[model samples]
Target: MRYEKGRKDASRSRIMEVATQRFRGDGIAASGLASIMSDAGLTNGAFYPHFPSKAALVRECVAAALEGQSGQIAQALASGGLATAVDAYLSAQHRDNPGTGCASAALLPEIAREQPETRQLYTERLMTLVRQVSAALPPHTSDPEAVAFGIFATLIGALQLARAVEGADLSDRILAAGADAARSMAQPRGGAGQEPAETGVTIAAKTERER
Candidate 1:
């Protein structure tokens, strides 16, 4: 019984993992259950036992994707501060890779059209991210929550715009510009005359292109 349960749990996890990649790479509407199941090395019939319906799977996948992104943001902020997190978020690598990138940027449009429950779940996850960003702001920032919201909005808009454009140079420029803007916003208001913070994210992004 223990082995069977363990095997079932593993299969369910694998299903969610593959579904996350597919839903992000191809829009949720474009990715069908049979294809997802086949990609997970399971037959179509195997999907029913794991997820009651396609929508159920989508809800689970959406939650998992957002949780994963939040975890990355928290780690980035912990290791390198807000500047590092912002820089990495608005970097070219993240822009080019939607499958493993921010869920909001990759699926906001489709999410808007989802059922109310799905939207509610997304909203909860989004607020979690906002709170994380808010807490990571500099100590002197007057209104951390509002500032965090603004920063988060900027990041999402910049990524969406960058991906919408056709040229590689233009995309890189957008990401760089966004990163600079985010870093500047993170600065304390009274420190306008102080030296800029040291953030190697932009430099790293440029180097990635050169390599």
Candidate 2:
């Protein structure tokens, strides 16, 4: 029985890893169960043994994707101030590596029409991200959550805009403007609308090529 349970756990993890990559690369709707199963080298029939339905898989993937991002976010927060963090986060690297990156940047629009369970799962993930960001901020503010919420909104919005444009120049501008915007948002109330903190973070300045 213990061996069976261990096998089930390993299978579930494999399913999650493959599904996450597929969902992020090609939006959730485009990535079907058969494809995910096939990619994981599991049969379609095996999907139901772990997840009851596609929505269940979506929920779990959403959770795992968000959890996966927590480490990057934490590193961003801990290593530098909010501006530097935004610099790293809004880079082309983060943009190009969608599969192993931010779920919000990759899949929110794809899951817009999902079921209630999926939506709830997304909401929880968003809340977790907000808390992580808020915890990284200066403690003088009365509403760290509010600040974090604003940052979250700005980053996702910027990514949406950047992803929409086709040109490399425009994409770079979008990321620069986004990092600037997020940096400004993270600033003190009296110092609003200023430029980014200019810690000279390399990731933010990396040229945007095909990836």
Candidate 3:
């Protein structure tokens, strides 16, 4: 009984891990349960014993992915400032490795269409990231929270545009530009009480208001 239980637990873990990759890379609806089970070298029957349904498994996988990303961001922050962390993040390697990279960049669009539980989980994960960035931001800013939002918007918009572009050169350029802009915005203004520039104007907001 003990041996069988251990095997079952291992299989369940494998399922969750595989599902996380597929759901992050693809969408939740595209990653069928049978395929996930087969990829884990298990039969379909074994899956039900672990999760009540596909949705349940997806929820678990999404939660796991969120937690994994949170841990990565935390580790990056522990090492250095926002620019340092972002320089590592918005790179060719990270862009190439979407399967195991930031969950926000990988799964933002899908999260909008996911169930309430998944959306809630995604929200919590994002808040954690915003908090991490906000903490790393320099003290001279008038509103650090607002600065955090600007930084995130810039990062996501650049990455999305980069991902949409076909050429490798353009993609890398977009990522680099995004990282540079984020770094520039993160710097505190000169001595004592100089107010930072109005850098929080989001690209989206500017385009809409301009139009």
Candidate 4:
């Protein structure tokens, strides 16, 4: 029954990796540990050593996905700016592959129904994400955090709606509309966050502490 530290760590990681995709592809309530363990190539008994319960696993998986997403958003914004990030997020590929895409888009409803601890973790992580986007907003922007929140809501809602509806045409239209709406949400009142549409929304200066 004894496993080395490294082996236990690897097994734990594998479990989370498989569970993340499973939870996103099939709702959390629908994904069983038996199946998740099977997918992770571990026996049912191995799971208990890594996590006390399915709720614990769910918390870990949610945190992992969001942490990865933070890097993705940073990369997208750095390479091409906000529009590119929005396009990538609202793309057909992302919509079709919920198993490996945004956690919020795939699991928002389930997260809302999770225990208070999990919900609190989500809120804290979400604020970090919002801040990342907010820091990139143009100078003199009015309430950039609120703007980022709106943009994230538009993107997450649009993706969820797109995946729910039947037909490529409607889904594509939804995605397109979502992108436009997210960009518009970023544009603050009184021309504070204004940027040339074609030029893309570049990052504003961040202080050394922020960096």
Ordered by TM-score, highest first, the candidates read: 4, 1, 2, 3
lDDT of 3 by residue, 1-211 (tens): 2348788788889999888888767767788988888888888888888899887887787677767766776787788757667777787877877777666777777778878987887677778778878888877576888888888888877877787799999898898789878877788866657644433345556688989
Q: Against the true structure, what is each candidate's TM-score?
A: 0.87, 0.84, 0.83, 0.89
In model 2, where is the ten-residue run with the lowest total lDDT? Answer: 194-203
lDDT per residue for candidate 1 within 40-110, as digits (tens), equals 99889888888888888889989999898899998998899998898899988888889888888889999
Q: How close to the true structure is residue 170 of candidate 2, measured as C-alpha lDDT?
A: 93
Tens digits of per-residue lDDT for model 2 on 57-120? 8889888888867777788777776767898889998777778778788887767888988888
RMSD list, candidates in order: 6.0, 6.7, 6.0, 8.2
Best by lDDT: 4
Q: What's model 4's overall lDDT?
A: 0.89
Backbone clash total, candidate 4: 0
Worst 10 residues of 3 by lDDT: 195-204
Q: Which residue ranges in model 3 land beyond 4 Å of their true spot?
A: 1-3, 190-211
Q: In candidate 3, how many clashes are counted?
A: 0
Can you list the residue pairs that collide in candidate 3? none
TM-score of 1: 0.87
RMSD over all Cα atoms, model 4: 8.2
Q: List per-prediction Cα lDDT, in the order shown.
A: 0.87, 0.80, 0.78, 0.89
C-alpha lDDT of candidate 2 relative to the true structure = 0.80
